[model samples]
Target: MNNTISSVCLPKTYTYDVEGQRVLVALTGNPFNYDPQTLYSLAARRNKKRGFLFVSKVLGKHVPVNPYVPLLAGINLGAHFIEKIHGVHQVDVQAVVEAVKKNEQTKEVYARVISQPRFVLPRETLFIGFAETATGLGHAVFSLFDNAHYLHTTRDKIPMLQPALDFNEVHSHAVNHLCYPENPELLKTSKTVVLIDDEITTGNTALNIIRAIHEQYAIKDYVVLSLLDWRTKDNRGNFRKMEELLCLKIRTLSLLEGEIDVSGSSYHEQSPQNLTTDTENRESFQVIVEEQLLNLQEVVSVFSVDVNGQESASPYLKVTGRFGLSSREDQDTLPLAREIGENLKPHRAGGKTLCLGTGEFMYFPMLISAFMGEGISYHATTRSPIYPFPKPGYGIQNAFTFPCPDDEGISYYVYNIPLNYYDELYVFLEREVSLERLQPMLRVFSQLGIPRLSLVIASPVSRKTEKR
Candidate 1:
């Protein structure tokens, strides 16, 4: 319970536990705290694998010049910072590979899974990255696989979407994906195709996507990979049904799989004040640590902002004077945001801020986290339908409900942010959203606390930049 830290966007919880250590140490490289040998030993026991491996997002953060790493060279993985590449960013190969090797050690039956024969992949294959998340991931995976042809899903307003085949990520922030293979014959002509993503759960996402391609392009062979495979027994059964229904063979490979069971209300329900994996029948996805909070006072100050869906300005904004991640290569994004997060930490007095983004806009929240100093609780709000469950054993839940920043008049990601933890809050809105609509938006944020709520919209409503 003592390990929790606070920051903007992320949920507050303990820093790291036994499970977290295993998951995190892959990227963290914190040697002295727990023996690298022990994590290696622990990971060795789980040995699980799939023919193809897909890594979840590999997440990274820049910590203030810590006093400890200099003293301990093993901890000096790098100055850019130690990031855990799981579920948060593009699945990091180092972490996924290490964890896969570790898990293989404990479970001998699983060991052989990671030991599959290495095949010489084509120099380039058609690569499909899911929207938003797999944006960067698709390319990363493409880089690893030979002859990778790369394309990602997008929300860009197009005159006509010549989708080869389409599928609805019904449970996603928005059930919208459009694909126009550069070469209409690419999928049709290729004998093998590789799909990239951060995680592969029920295999529904993979199945539907694969089905779409197969139906439209008639690609017969496919490979699915993720950092973790938390597919339950039923989910696997349904996967087989989809395979039989489509009459195609699909193969999946992963670095790790959930050993502990998970089945509860919604995967996200517990408050920032009470995050405990100890609950019965509940398995939790984590950035780090576990905790049973003793008080709310530990929450220093909370800053909340609602991210707009537009792709301009920056992927994320900052209250503490730091810039976060930007999707496009803007000369303006990197230097400013990185500078702010790095310099702001030492000035802080151990307070917490909650930076909440609009539905489906997770990339911004993630960028903001990298800007924050240590002790920040990180989690973005999404519009996906999730049950408001706070007990253990819940695997999935809708995150939140919010209108689209675009003209579609839609709603997106709706989980992870609860208002009780904030003391001071901020909301980011575009200039076009009139004060009337903005009023209702502010009303939602008012629940956090009375603050000199600040807003930013550099461009006016009539001529703002186009959304990506």
Candidate 2:
């Protein structure tokens, strides 16, 4: 079955009876403007704190999906947001609705954008994407904005980069997120800030980040951008109040909006639960995996910031659009991506391959993976820990555990890869690494029987650091 949002994987109205209450998620087409069923599939969450997970077919998380789907989702969403900002949202919304009525996928819908007039924001406008899930989506949206600056939150903190702001995602497997922009001035002078995430369940996480940033800097306006918005009526009211309390204007733009009903025997009022997991060793799959690992090829590449023709190495130098990226820096991305893709071409023999970014190091690998063609799927190693239940219809099927070198206390996970599916794997990182950090991931892939492997490590350099 095609797992994309435009496929028959979901229906207009989906009902689930869990934990005794009959819950319904309705995505009717006519009046509401967009189809929620076309955007997401409802699945059970492995975390008991949250009963249901709104599995996004386009977000490229939890599911193996085409890379273009999520990228187009962000670009279209960015176009919609620009229209809303310019007070011409009706035209854009109608165009999107028409595109959906024709059952268009991300690429087709993105083409409809030509029907709308161009909209631009100030050069100083800042775009921030939530980490792990929305990192690429957020960057894609920023790319559509011409020269706007972009940064995604990261749970990993680089020693060389000073922290600008920090916040918590209370219900997430990894709760803390730190922002360490290489150029501190990027956040200080912005008049409008656009916060992007894959989904907004309660609006609390957005509120937390907004509250934290508003405390440091006085912002004129804030835009909450997401592919899906499931915030309740009360949640909307609270956002309005937050706007008033912060003395700033707040707005939200999403492709789909509706209520999710999570009822029945599975529903429980959850306490603030800590993320804990019991590691499972898949001894049965070890032999085949070792054979594949032995046959795999490995390569490493590095990028350093140039200063007067001299290359200098620094951990947080901002090469991958981690902080804010402009058009000039972005120009280097395509060629580098093409180079990475060319290097992996000889290993392509028809089976599936995957490119993985370790934690917040996602956008660069995602971009490079796109150049590797259709067979290469993209995802990341995330700090979020979820229960791995290999049952049908669950969001998380299989998970590979690795120690988080960035944070020794917490373990990282890469999920949903079935055994023997991927023929090759490419791993990307931002820093020079030791073999200690790679062993777990290598062991996991070896166990899964993925024969070929490529490791790309790029170091970042900052203009600000060079100036000093």
Candidate 3:
């Protein structure tokens, strides 16, 4: 007799009850294309080019993304534009909450979206959202598409993360290009694969993904959804071109229309000359994490971790440790988080000093903050933000932009800690570092107005000072 046990993983999405279930996508104001000043002061006069611009053969502003279009993104994403354009929105965030409430309007919108004469999604149909950008909207859509398997691509990299289908976004941060897709079968067998993103700029990103998926899974039909659609009537030609190119049909919907002005050639690189500098002093900075922020919901467990390696002081800062795992937690992440958390001590949360984590570094901080009592706020920046486009009275919902690192560029994420927002910060990394790279990163933070507070969670010890 063969012994068998059920798999701990989620079952195929084909088996779910969607008898009367509906999924809807709503837009607040018109769609604003993302072409904002990536490095602007919040209160600075709003640039006229801010907001999504529609550039097609019809509205031929066609230079590239930044050259023709200017948009405001981060501070508050597209929600900000909605508040500005339609007195109807409350800039503080309730509008997005209200818009997402899924009331009757939500039901009606879903009814239109899932317009199949019959009810219920077919078995094997999956919801595939883009990484970094559509992280939230994908989750929201998942809430409604309860019957669908919910998994979004992630830029986060653990020691070992595999990608189902890796693709590219011409305009995105370099570090986040590695997308770890959750469902490998997502490209295969699913009849309806929903491509969700915040906004559709050139529709290039979507086109790229669609092309990749076609080349891989070869799905015949795909649907593109967003809070706003900036594509003008002429942009439809590109859609037709892709349709002919891939022999697949891609349909899109949004609450309204907007446009993005283009100025430079598509290949023009917009790397900021001095955004992400790499030579800040390391030990000059220190970190204190707030403890009250441990154990983030429904995900990983939080625990106390001890350092594995001895600490030393030298021209370079050295810190290393193994993250202890709680019995209730998955053992895999323990060694990593704990090993790093210990040396980062004097841990405290809820204050000006921030312990910013790289993608999967989320758990380490959660655990580290457990030791760090009240003096910190724990949040990480996804490679996404709302940006101002050149169009009028419209906004782009979710597009991501990063400072070109070629010159010392800054990588802004959804959780942007504007320099004015915090006294100082200690950016934590999951990558290997030298004293030079780690130290200078700190000094740079100091220059930004606050003393730098940094910690080396997992770095090698140096010969200058053998013991801590």
Candidate 4:
């Protein structure tokens, strides 16, 4: 498809009244003259710390969008960054659109473009993607950089895994994020870094992480990549101050750079905090779990990790992030995604299918979802808990809660999906699963009247070796 960014809806003024404070959100910049509505819209956040949320239209989290949209958006941003890094001005929107087309026509073009970096990063540079939303975006961008290591922060901690760095996202419901690279040298050898996120509101989180990483390892160049740059005038100035303080060059890139004005009253508006059903009035919904129908596999692969002369075999396939994903695994992503799609087609013979990824395990599942044919929607279960208001103009209308497979105590949610919208649902997991972990979600789906549900398990390829 010859899709162009011109078709995107441009920004306009948005205003809302929240908790007695009058909030006004307006779009200020249209560098690409793209439609702001097509890119994002304004929604009031449930969190008191942040009143307004610039909900992305392309991100499949709060809303269901064509899988191609978010994937293409990230690729486009990568192209722009490449242009800037190489000092090539000719690689404009048209060039990016063409490149996307070429990529769609054949994987050869995509491979060629990604392998041959238009701009090279320092040999020691690391590409880190924020948890949840930007995990996929960062993966896409990381593929475009030559010889760069990739890792994404996570709220879920693996057993016996230690973080190389940990930081806080103040505005997020789950504030703390842990970064664990299998090889400590992945962070030790880093001299430059690119922080990827869905958007940059205050740039504070980026700054916070930068400071945390610098405290541990020296970094010289820092770049922030996002789908939208909504940093206020003061926020942009803060970056300059941070640069001087941190003694590093800080830059930002985005498909859209603009302002949002939030004006609303201080009158408190109560939104539904969590899914509640009146015990007396609630209808009895029966839920059933058919474990025999679920495609659960136990691959007895041997994974070795050597630390301090101790060698042990772990029954895990640790291909990528949390421990960090290498260049080889990055190269395998496309082919693996294609194989997954082919394997999933027979199972998708139902109307309005939904592909759901496990929390923090987003990028790979999203790619598989996008490739699973039309009338298919994609989103991942997230650790961030947002309130659902059953009203128009609200981003989250309905939410389904379930126990996270990795950590059963922590709750995860898939939002905006109504009970019967999708007749078929596919849940993708990056780790091995258990009947215990899958029961909660399966029961939720059964209650929602989803006719067919399948669990697809593809563990990451274990590339860990004993480092002499």
lDDT of 1 by residue, 207-257 (tens): 788877877767766766544455766877876777788787676554344
lDDT of 3 by residue, 1-468 (tens): 011223233220111111111111122233332212211111101123221122121010111111001111111233343243223342334422222322113223332332322113444445555554344344334332223454455443333335565677765543233433333454565765666665675677778777877887888777776645656457767888989988888877543434423333211123223222232432333433211222122221111111222222211111111111111223223344444445454542226555554433333443343233334444434432333223322222122233311112334432233333555454544333344544433444444444445553432222222222
TM-score of 4: 0.81
* Candidate 2 lDDT, 1-468, residue by residue in tens: 012222243335556543233557654222335455456655444465676566676666656665555656676678778777865452355545544344345345544553343345654678899887888788877766545677888765444556788999887876777776757887888888899999887899899989988999877689998888777779899999998888888899887766666655432334234322223454424422211111111111223322123332434435455666754555555566667666666656556887777776766666666667667787777765554556655456766777764444556777778777887777776664456645666676677767666666654222222321
By summed lDDT, the worst window of 10 consecutive residues in model 4 runs over 1-10
Q: Rank the candidates by lDDT, best first.
A: 4, 2, 3, 1
C-alpha root-mean-square deviation, each candidate: 15.1, 7.3, 17.5, 6.4
Minimum summed lDDT over a 10-residue window in model 2 is located at: 290-299
The residue pairs that clash in candidate 2, if any, are: 18-263, 18-264, 18-265, 19-264, 19-265, 19-266, 20-264, 20-265, 21-264, 289-446
lDDT tens readout by residue for model 4, 378-399: 7778766555556665566666
Question: Who wins the TM-score comparison?
Answer: 4
lDDT score, candidate 3, position 154: 47
The runs of at least 3 residues in candidate 3 whose Cα sits more than 4 Å from the true structure, single-residue gaps closed, are 1-123, 150-163, 171-183, 244-247, 262-440, 446-468
Stretches of candidate 1 exceeding 4 Å from the true structure: 1-122, 125-161, 170-176, 180-193, 196-202, 215-221, 227-249, 255-350, 390-402, 405-409, 412-414, 418-420, 423-435, 450-468
Stretches > 4 Å off in candidate 4:
1-12, 16-22, 89-92, 95-123, 265-320, 390-393, 460-468
